[model samples]
Target chain A: MFPTPVEKRSRAAQITYQSLVPLALILWLLPLIAVALFSIRPGVDFANGNYWGVPSSFELFTNYGRVFFESDMPRYLWNSVLITVPTVIGAVALSCMTGFALGIYRFRGNLLIFFMFIAGNFVPFQILMVPVRDLTVDVGLYNTKMGLVLFHIAFQTGFCTLFMRNFIRALPYELIEAARVEGVKEWRIFWYIVLPLMKPAIAALSVLVFTFIWNDYFWAVVLTQGPDAQPVTAGITSFNSQFVAQYHLMSAGSIVAALPPVLMFFLMQRHFIAGLTLGAVK
Target chain B: MTLPTDPPTQTWLQRHRMIITPLMFLLPGVAFFAVYVISPILQSFYISTFEWTGLGSLSEQGEFIGMQNYRELMSDRNFEVSLWNNVKWLVLYLLAIPGGLFIALFLNQTVAGIRVYKSLFFFPFVISQVVVGLVFSWFYLPNVGLLNVVLGWFGSEVNILGNPDLATYGIIAAGLWPQTAYCMILYLTGLNAVDPEQIEAARLDGAKGVRMLWHVILPQLRPATFIAFVVTIIGALRSFDLISVMTNGGPFGSTRVLSFYMFEKALSEYGFRMGYGSAIAVILFLIMLIFISYFLWTMWRDERAARL
Candidate 1:
């Protein structure tokens, strides 16, 4: 609206605007588009210096099929699903109760506790690296999916609590008050009342957390070592090494590693953006 | 025991529910955060005070070498380079804000297929940074990639990632690809909620284009800008993924930020000096704390206003 909609402008301007949007989009995503193009080509194309030419033969399925059948790609993908799903459920579950308490109550240190989660949320992962890794090893959970999942759930709760608290704060307090007047038990009120109102937040946070945990490379590199537990984000490094300079297969592997989250973003664009913007300042 | 009409007595759980309920609800979340997040921060500080290889428990095997790691950091040349590169990253990464706003404004229209266009523009952000690094690494390939191809038309060629002087910038450019997309999405969402009435009022007063943007539009997009600032600052600091995937902090070790440097010291094949890594982490933490305090201050002010 601030730019003044194209419809309100001259016909030439409108036509220019329409063409410009796609042009800009093309330029913006050109790098990714190049990778997508590479994923479908034969490996020999690179051997002959055909880096940017039309593919001589399409090997889309063949290249992707090698990634699936001839490697540990599936195992890593499974590990990622195992790691991501539990973290989402655990973090969201914990935050719901935390958010409920922080949003509804006026207890001592409420703001302090709320700010602690927020501040923790912002702390660089480097600061926690040595200690967390040591802690994981000490518990003998190193190289295990459970250890990674535990750390992720704990770490993600910080942001999830912040998000969920803000959302729950926006819910009508009168609804809780009216329920209290009926002498409904407190936890029951949370279960039968507030949790139901939190469906959208849960959906948004779940998808956001899923994408985050899936794309997580640092912890996957640190806490887990082998393909047994490494997610695709980290495993793709070895995948690249195994097929070194085989750009066709490497591109396919990278695309496969990136696809789940891209799909999540596309499938849930509204909720994903809502989760991100957080509407913090205004 | 009294007559049937007598009121039921309040159980202790029911009577003290106000204090107890929130406490109960907060317990698990607070516990997890304290153990995994809060306690580790304090532990990092403690660990920074000792010399440990991280083979055994810190208290038993670690020697009390107070301030030694920090002293080493002061003299370490790699640390010096990393610190400077971090400064470069912090300054340049913010270009994404204006870059994103420009793209957002350009795309902020009701044209045909605009939704698909916007989503496609935001495509880079949804994927992992490793892939972004790979994409850009290939994009900057010496003679054959898109960047060199474009430059070839002008008869100039530079090996970007292979050059020590240019590698960090190349990686930062890779970083900006996604960071800009992130900021663009934020602004697009912010722009959607901008008050059209205020724009109509301004248009009557003859404020248009850049003048209108500076006066009316940007002020409304404050929240988006704040978020963009927060994420970009954090992203700039947490720039390990691209560095690891693309350069591995090489080209004469020119691209290491404190985060990557810390990891190299604490882990990797460099022999684990847990204390030294924690020391570097502590420094990064202190830098981050400055921004964290300012953000928390602003949010506190907002929360206070909302309370009344």
Candidate 2:
């Protein structure tokens, strides 16, 4: 609206605008396009110096199959699933109650507690790295899926609480007041009254958390080790080192590693964008 | 209401229910959050005063070498390089805001298949940074890369990532690809809510293009711009995944941002100097604290205003 819609402009101007859109998008996504091309490329193509050439043969199945069967990629993918699913559930579940409390009740230190969560969410990970790893190792949870899950759940609670609190605050208070007048217990009121209305928030947080934990490379490397516990993001880097010359295999693995989150984003596109743009607009 | 006199126990319970109920709900979340996030931050500060390999018991094996780690960080060349590199990152990462605004403005119009184009442009941000690094690494490969191939047409083939001086910039360029997309999406959302009446009013007043955008549009886009600035700064500072995937802070460690360098010092094969790593982490934490405080202050003011 600010720029004046192209439809209202002169015919020549509209033509110029239409032509630039695709060109701009193509350039923006060129890196990803190259990777997708490389993923489907035959191994022989890279050896023959056909990096930019049309693939001599489309080996999508073989490449993806090899990534699944011939490497530790399957294990890594399973690890990501194991870590991410529980984190989404745990973080969301915890934040629901915390958010309800902070949003609905006006207790002493309420704002202070809320700000604590917000502040903790933005602290650089390095501050928590050494001690978290130490604590994980000391608890004998290091190099384990549960360790990563616990850490992620706890860390993500900060952001999830911020989101859930704001959302709950925006919900109409009349329902809560009516429930209170009927002498319903607070917990039951939350369960029956607020929780049902929170389905959209829950969905949004679940998808966003799923993508975040799945794509987490730092904590995966720090809190876990090797195929036994490491998620695909970290595993792919190790894969890169092992198959240094096998760009096709590495590229295939990268695509596979990146698939779940991309799928989640596309599948839950609305919720994902809603969750991400939470504070972007007033 | 006093027809039946309540027992003291029941009356007391009823009186304190408000405070007790909220605390009960907050307990589990607060416990986990305190142990994992809050306590560790404090622990890091404590650990920064000691010397340890992080392999053994803290009290029995570690020495309380107060301020030694911080002093060493001052003289350490890698630390200096990482600090300077972080400054460079902070400066350059800001380019994403304007870049994204430009793209958002370009695509803000409704056209045939524009939704698909917008989503495709946003593809980079949804994927893992590891993939971004790998793709860019391949793109910067000296001879066979797309970049070199394009440059070769002009008779130039430069090894961008392999050169120490150019490696950081190359990686930053890769980072910007996704970062700019993120900012663009934020701005697009902001633009969607821009008041059409105000735009019409400005247009009728003979304001157009850059002048109109500068005077009318940017002020409305403040929230989006603020969020963009916050995330970009945080992303620039927490740049470990891409650096780890692309260079491992190599080409003679030219791209060692503080986060990666702390990991290298504390955990990686270089050595297990946990104390030194904590010191580095503390510095990064302090730098980030400044920004975090500003963000929280603004949010608090807004929250108070909303409540009132």
Candidate 3:
């Protein structure tokens, strides 16, 4: 709207703008396009030096089958789900109360506590790595998916609290005050009142936390060692090492590793953007 | 007087409800956060002063080398390179803001199926970085990579990823895919918020094209730009996956960043030097702290002023 719609521009300018869009998108996505192409390429081409040439046949199913049959990819996917779903539920649940307490209750250290969550959200993960790993080992949860999930729920609570607090603060206080005047207990006021109204925030955070934990390569590698506990992202890394230069197979594995989050994003695009653009417009 | 629909007698369970109810809702989450989140931060500070590998008992004998790891890192060349790569990443990664803005402007039109195109354009960000790195690695493969093939048509066959000089940039390019998409979304939201009245006012003043964009649109886009800047900076500094997947600080370790180097020192191919790694982590943490404090300070001041 700011640049004046295409019809407002000259015919030549309109054609140029239209033509540039696809060209730019193609150039922008060249890497993904190439991998998508390669994943379907026949395995025979691996020896023929035809890696870049157009595929002679599509064998994506066979390559995918090999990844499933020969690798621990399924286990990795399950681990990712195990870690991600709990973290999402845990983080969101914790943050909702934290957010409400910080946003609604004008108590001492409220801003300070809010800022703690904010600062905690930004701290480098490395600082947390050594000690977190040590603690996990000490608690006898080392190399277990539970170790990673417990850490994730906590770490993610920082950001999720930041988001939830801001969102809850933006909600009108009058509704809560009106309920309070009726002598409604604060807990019921939250549960029967505020909790149901927070669906949008919960939805946004779910999609966000899902993606963050799913694509979490750093923590996965650091906390978990092998197929027993490794998530898909780390699984893909091992797969890459084992299938080195087996481009088709690697491509197929990459696609599989990337599928769940990509599908989540597409399905929940609105919620994803809503969560991401939290303070962008303000 | 208002009449109650039910008997007003207090039940035995209702006496201390205020204290118990919130506690019941809050206990589990708070316990998880404390055990997993809050305590580890304190422990990291404590662990930074001593030596320990990731396995076995910490009491088994770690030399208490106070600040030696940090002191040693101060003189280490690899640490310096890693630090420099982080600086490079911080700078170049910001290109996503303008890159995204340009794409957002281009696609702001209401062409047929533009919604589909916008989603497709944003596809890169939705996928995991592991996949993006793998894709780009193929795109930059020595002979058969599509990038080299495209360059071949122009009579040049350069192996971007194989060259130590260009490998970091190659990975950075891959990183830009998602980063640019993120920025595009921010700008799209900003564009939606731009006041039509101001643009109509500017158009009446004969402002158009670059002049309009510079004078009218950009100022309105300030909030989005700031968010874009913050996310881009944080994302750049936090870059680990793409580098790990694409180059692994390879071709003579030209692509090492502080984060990756910290992981390498703490865990992977390099031996587990937990104390040394924590020391490096401290340095990275301190660097990030500078930005974090600045962001918090600015936001704090803004929030306070807004309340006034």
Off by over 4 Å in 2: B1-11
The alpha-carbon deviation from the true structure for residue B114 of candidate 1, after best TM-score superposition, in angstroms, is: 0.8
DockQ of predictions, in order shown: 0.65, 0.72, 0.57
lDDT of 1 at B35: 97
Backbone clash tally (model 3): 0
> Model 2, range B149-210, lDDT digits (tens) per residue?
89999999999888999999999999999999899999999999999999999999999999
Candidate 3 lDDT by residue in tens digits, A1-282: 687998787999888878888898787777887888888888779789887766778797888999899888889999999999998998999999888777776655678877877888888888888878878878888889999998999989889988988898899898988886687888888888888889999999999999999999988888888989999999987887788778888888889899998899889989998999988887
- Model 1, B1-308: lDDT tens per residue? 22233247877877789989999999999999999999999999999999999988998999989999999999999999999999999999999999999999988988778898888888788899988999899889889888898899999999999999999999999999999999999999899989999999999999998999999999999989998999999899989999999999998999999999999999999989999999999999999999999999988998999989
Clash count of each predicted structure:
0, 0, 0
Off by over 4 Å in 3: B1-31
- Candidate 2 local lDDT, A1-282, one digit each (tens): 878899998999999989888887778777777788888989999899898888899999999899988889999999999999999999999999999999999978999999999999999999999889989999999999999999999999999999999999999998998887767788998899999999999999999999889989999989988999999999997887777888888889998999899889888988988898888888
Error of 2 at B168 (Å): 0.8
Highest lDDT against the true fold, candidate: 1
Alpha carbon lDDT at A32, candidate 2: 75
